[model samples]
Target: MTLDRSRWQPRTTTFIVLMAAANALLYHAPLFSFAADHLEVGSFSGILTLVTALVALFSSTALLLSLLALVSHRLLKPICMVLAITSSIAVYFVATYQVVLDRTMMGNVQNTNLAESLELFHPKLLVYLALLGLLPAGLLAGVRVEKSPRLRVAAMAASVLVLTVTWGWMASGTWGWIDKNAKRLGGLVMPWSYVMNTVRSAAPKLWQSDVQILLPEAAFTDDEKSVVLLVIGESARAQNFSLYGYERPTNPQLEKAGAEALQSTMASSTYTTASVRCILSHVDSSSEFSTRYEPLPSYLQRHGVDVIWRSKNTGEPPIQVQTYETARELARDCPGPERDYDEVVLTGLEERIRSSSSQKILVVLHQAGSHGPSYSTKYPIHFEVFRQVCESVELGTCSEEELYNAYDNTILYTDQILSRTIDVLKRIPAASPLLIYISDHGESLGEYGLYLHGAPWMIAPDVQKAVPFIVWMSEEFTERRNVHPAQLQAQTAHSQRDIFHTILGALSIQSEVYEEEYDIFNESFSNR
Candidate 1:
């Protein structure tokens, strides 16, 4: 076989330059600030960046090599052109996947279908299509270069230089990387530390000790039957939910259950740590809940209602706030057992209901509603109705279909749990008053090529903040509690900022710190 030096020359040079620039741009995109934050542009981050560039180059080159083998030299010109164009598409989609879908898979997207997954390809598909039509055509037209070695050297240098400059920008705060590169950079090494730091830093004000605790005055009389159930969901984005009209049947159960569900469209937070603290405490999502501030538990305790927090999703010791301890004392035996299984907690709470009758009960069920990587872990074996089931814990190894199957399974299972809880609330001997379900923050499932949740507020979509709020009250309890159905309907379109005060108002605890402006029941509260 005669070696076609001319053909190889053009192909190799094109591969070198195109791969280098694409690799450089992808690695150094503004999305990798988190990776740069911990590693900076020092020897370590530099080496990592170099490794990433090299891997990208090898991967792209490997594709080129395969193309060379598959096609003959006679058609080498068109083959290289096709490979170059496809490579560009691959680069964009992969970059978009890394930036968007990959990140979401790490966090949420508990359940998705083919149609749902197709929704994820939108922005990236358009971007890559545009690139394929324009950039590759221009590059192919400028072929016929004999200087392959020179191009290789230039490409390598440019990639390294891009890496160096990206590191510099990340360290200087001129760019943000957590939005794009947090899962890869942060999850790989620092894991919890990286996530915690980003969540904590997301609200710098929560670090302060001078924060104030706002408690709403309870409206219930001492003689009235009062019960408040705060069910906190995990990684439940409002947009994907049918309750929020995602055009899919994702939240069909909630929609059909006849429960009052408030779909907040504008709420935005990416992770549970930051968002839960904000919602559970009297603090606003715009601020952090620090130790300096007395959270809802303290206020509830002062008002003489039993404040019990049964948690499953939050860590052993709740991060970002110390107030978890106050409720912990009341809930030592409330959540059932130490099992990672959420159903155990639910079952245990059910047992508690059967065993004792606390006059005023504030039950906080910390949901494992859609915690990610292995969405199957969130539910038990019975909820495997979805066709594709992913039982693997190794996230990277799982197929996209398997992942979607597992995640949506979790969502489906969560729906069961929600229904059961509603059934329990309705069967509360016609005594217990109200049950409310709300998530701390929402999750991002493969949207815009972005995968997980916890992207910065500026970059995070409505999925993270738009949470589901389901309220169920017995007819007697609703009428006795003076909650007008019309009012509850109106409030369904309201924000979660009303929860703190609404709970207090329902409990009827008197507190001077309670601001009607911040209360959910307060008509003026929605204005903010």
Candidate 2:
């Protein structure tokens, strides 16, 4: 089996093809597995389409590598080594968490904080790195590439032509299936998924302006001492909440406190950045152009409303406020066993409001509620109401019951935070406090063989898009704003987009940009 070492050098094109083949086989198990589960392999057209799709994937990868190699033989090894390492890490998360590599998911990866990123570390990841990453990288480093730039370029051109022809020929028979599963397929392809998506995610930043477009001038109708606590929950799905008829006691406190759980509410997106932007923007910021406008906090602050943002989690849009505190900074003043948890965001909250001299105040608390796969760690041990919780970050290793219990416990803990937040608002009766709790997005608890969140909105399950939208108005707030809890409960077809206008309506802030149709509280107002 041994060959002469001096004679073992492969041409640049052959080397690139081999590396691409290795990447496709080693890092694309999820892709093939998904295809196997979804594709109709019984029919001849299905088989031909599947085979063509596989060929397309391999050829595309090889073509990309060949083009890189054409740039310089010296660059090929380093580029592939980096790809191998990154692809290994990507596949680990992709397989273990059932998360796909899309532009949004890549954005999430880039936006993730060090603390949150550290939680994903496991021994299995090391194994994947060593076996799939370093081993191939080492082999790539040792391999000899014959300097044949012409061959690489020709090979690349031929691959592109062949792949295009094959794809176009198969399009008639496979277009429906491909279009139906495009997001999933695009997200599962090795190297290309993360590589292409990372570029796609970052490409907008190159041309988009950082300067936010100012909203219309706003004015307060009355000098009412109003306070709005907009609690942005993390990954808290409606399907897990008892208030949403989940048959679980995960929301005992919320149910007992009579929190108005709005029906038919959906998130703007499946990921935090987009969903949070939609929640905070005056208009739906899911569209590219809409993101240029100033967010709710910034807009409200500009109108002389005292805005305070306290975050235990990240991924919110640019917030320009007087007071912005993180979990670590707040933890210094907060003293309790629950200080490490999301309860820290509420520390001294009543006092902060009581001391405020402003006529209107908006306190935004971004909570780390139910963010997984370390769900059991999100809450305090006392909140582990469900037994046999899954403690492992590798969610697939745990039983369905164990995984559910862990995730439910996080929801249970979230219930406590929301109820406690309402209590904080109730004590500040002089402020005419209003509480609005909406999750940035929902999580997938092993539904359709998918775990965690961040699936593309189009393909995401109901559990990933159907978020909990709970609102609680103080007696004073209800009477002053003319927004009854019953009215809010009766409202349907609500979404995260309503949050921006609803807050304005509740505070009686008159603005040209405010839309009555999007405001949930607008119907109850006499003038409206």
Candidate 3:
């Protein structure tokens, strides 16, 4: 049965319409599913609203595709193929992880290093690409389109007017409902979600100044040696930590070492880049380039304080410091199996502090803690206190218990690392050490069908926003600063924004930019 190849060819307008319909139907399951779950399908008004929304979505997509296909005969097929392939990839992540491709999430995608991105690879992803991407793309490649530019242009203009009227009518009655779910709805629309958001996230970088606005001049209040070790944890949620009343003993080492856990603390954002910037910024500003200022590390370094940054993770803001070391760089001095883990960041830490000539020192250790879907691989085998852990990157394949055990073990490993760090600080009594640990953002583990972080912050669950804030100070540090552990722990309700001012207060650095109200250690204690 031989078929004529000429029969398969269609006009440009027809091809665009078919492609738009295919994309709306095939790649929009998540959007329609969300709509179905929220709308009252049993009622007439809800059904009408749903139908109108669907029509709007289809029409808008068709109009956009029509414009692209009509622009040039040479580039029509290539554009369609690219959209097909990219939409398939976008839908896979949106549906599998239940993540929204908002600006922050898109920023996360751009900021992800190759090693971190590789963790997302799974067999299911390949299946999606083959079926949804390559199949359509291959079909588009073989089809010949008959050009009818004038007719297509006329049809598209009519569509634009019709769609505009239809949207205005729909908005009069359903604007509130649509506005409420705009973030989720915008994030679920295939191709446009990642496409527009990537631009939205990257556009700000263009206007940002190359040089930071330097903060007011600061001076040390005392000549005493002070070292603040700020450990920026990655994807660590407070809900799982035993220190925050979790049933599991995930914080055994931290508890034994007498670390103070502040109960009320929320992350500023659900993603690392924004949350880390907030943690370092002088003010509690939204994730916008307009509010850019000197980060804590750079500000401290400029004030003659020795600042050393050790990172096992990416996504920290631009920093200006004398010493910045990555895990691979630090691996030379560190040996054995633990060297590959986050414990590698602690290589020669005590030696560095002892050898420093500055009276004030700040060492920032950015940890790759509990980054998901390969949680079981994050810690050593000995740290796997819980049994029957999930080893697969496909999170949905694992049972609830398996997923939890693997994630908990990472927290347990984190407990050990923090404890070991405390031990090192304890040995350096002359430096009057202080350890402050807080996650850049929290993680979501099968909560409300959400697997990983980076949902829009307004709608993200508490598990994704609530992070652990732990502090450990030596007796010398407490005495020199005239602060008590009980007083510090008693005053609750903290946030990542407080970190900037708290570090300044602890180091006794006087600056006009330092806000006393934001400093957690300044409740009743005086640094004078």
Candidate 4:
């Protein structure tokens, strides 16, 4: 008993070191894999290089927290407690889902309201949070550590000073190389990646003005009855869609519905918020733009088009429009689950379409299609054609086959929702209704050991860039816009940038802001 107690060790520093080691080993297998795959240790001299490269994976966070622990004896316990909870939650999610906690995802988490965030919680998550965070935090609560505050503060300062001096000296010659790689290294560290990312992501939005650019007056060219429905799909890659030639019947409904499968269409960015904004903005893909910038919706509304943005996606808000409906808000009137699926956006939409006697109308339905790591839940039970799905948020437990099945099912579900949307639009007799469905961006399903979307646009994979862009316009609508389906289909390459101008051209809404070069249908329309 005495030997066991002695071996167990009562030191807080020792416990922290052991915990850090365990966390690094268990939750950071991806970091080890990355280092091992990339490192070229040809000789003894290269060993130090490899170790130095992997320091962020194993020792960086540990060293930082250890020094911080010495700051104040009074503050140490609470700091450690908070770190324990956050680390557990962070590590569990990243390891299980095989996701990188980047700035975009952190922003999404921060921007999500309480009701939307609540959707992430389940019994499985509760269990993980308890075991990893609450359990460890509870253990720390019972432990008592004595320290001299003045002496500890001095020690912490000394430790930081030494670390800074040594780091600068060692990194001086290779400072540029180190600086370039620091961001990647930070992303590899367990818990800190998510913890710091969450803080950083929220930082931008806090100071950012919600005041969108409100335009004065927008006028239609003629009294043409047209209603353009622009549906934005989320996290749906073109590779998985059968319409793009995948073997699976993922897009059976859309294929039968005669939706024009755009060839070689790509997204502006690999994320929802960025891609959606870019698609809506007048700026071309060649030009750079910030996500906070809003123009498209406001432009349409100002130019006298009845514009409305309805969404179920997190972090996606209306662009300078009063007529915006969230899933929860729609659910109160639509009569379904608070946030069931993409179809929820369709609820009460037909009525809105019928009521609107406007010459030109634009409705943007933002679907939560194939958004991970809960793909199975996005679709109804009937649409679960692809069986043996990975239902758990911890996708690591599921096989690659299961993950594909789950994701594919969501795609199939998206197919149904889109087809149904077209059916609803068909009811509009007077208006030349057309439904343009395009995904914001694509997703990675265990590709190169990466899962989900939001890789940096500069280094993003084709799966993250290649998106589905489909056009389902009625025969009357096709004639009204002077669109040659053959020419539209023959055109090989396309992008999200074309969307802003194409809509303006299609509706014959002439504005100085509309660039003909960016409009795909401009060439087809000889009238303009």
When 3 and 4 are scored with TM-score, the better candidate is 3
What's the lDDT for residue 121 in model 4? Answer: 57
Global lDDT of each model?
A: 0.55, 0.85, 0.86, 0.73
The C-alpha TM-scores of every prediction are 0.58, 0.94, 0.95, 0.82
Candidate 2 lDDT, 45-72, residue by residue in tens: 7787677677767778877877776677
Candidate 1 stretches with Cα past 4 Å from truth are 1-220, 246-256, 288-291, 315-340, 354-358, 390-403, 430-432, 491-493, 517-528
* Alpha carbon lDDT at 70, candidate 1: 39
- For TM-score, candidate 2 versus 4, the one ahead is 2
Q: Candidate 1 — what's its lDDT?
A: 0.55
Model 3 Cα lDDT, one tens digit per residue, 1-528: 754567678887777678767877889888888888899977876777676666667777777777776567668788879888998888888888989998989999999999988999988888889999999998887788888676765586577658767676855676677788988999998878888899999997898777888889998898888889999999999999999999999999999888899877999889988899899998775745425788999999999999999999998888999999999999999878878899999999889988899989999999999999899989999998898999998898899999999999999999999999999889886888999999988898898889989989888999999999999978887787777877876776888888998999989999998988788778743322
Give the lDDT of residue 339 in candidate 1. Answer: 47
| Model 2, residue 142: C-alpha shift (Å) | 0.9
Query: In model 4, which residue pairs have backbone atoms overlapping below 3 Å?
Result: 218-302, 218-303
The lDDT, on a scale of 0 to 1, for candidate 3 is 0.86
Model 3 vs truth, CA RMSD: 2.6
| Candidate 4, run of 10 with poorest lDDT | 1-10
- 10 in model 2: Cα distance from truth in Å? 1.5
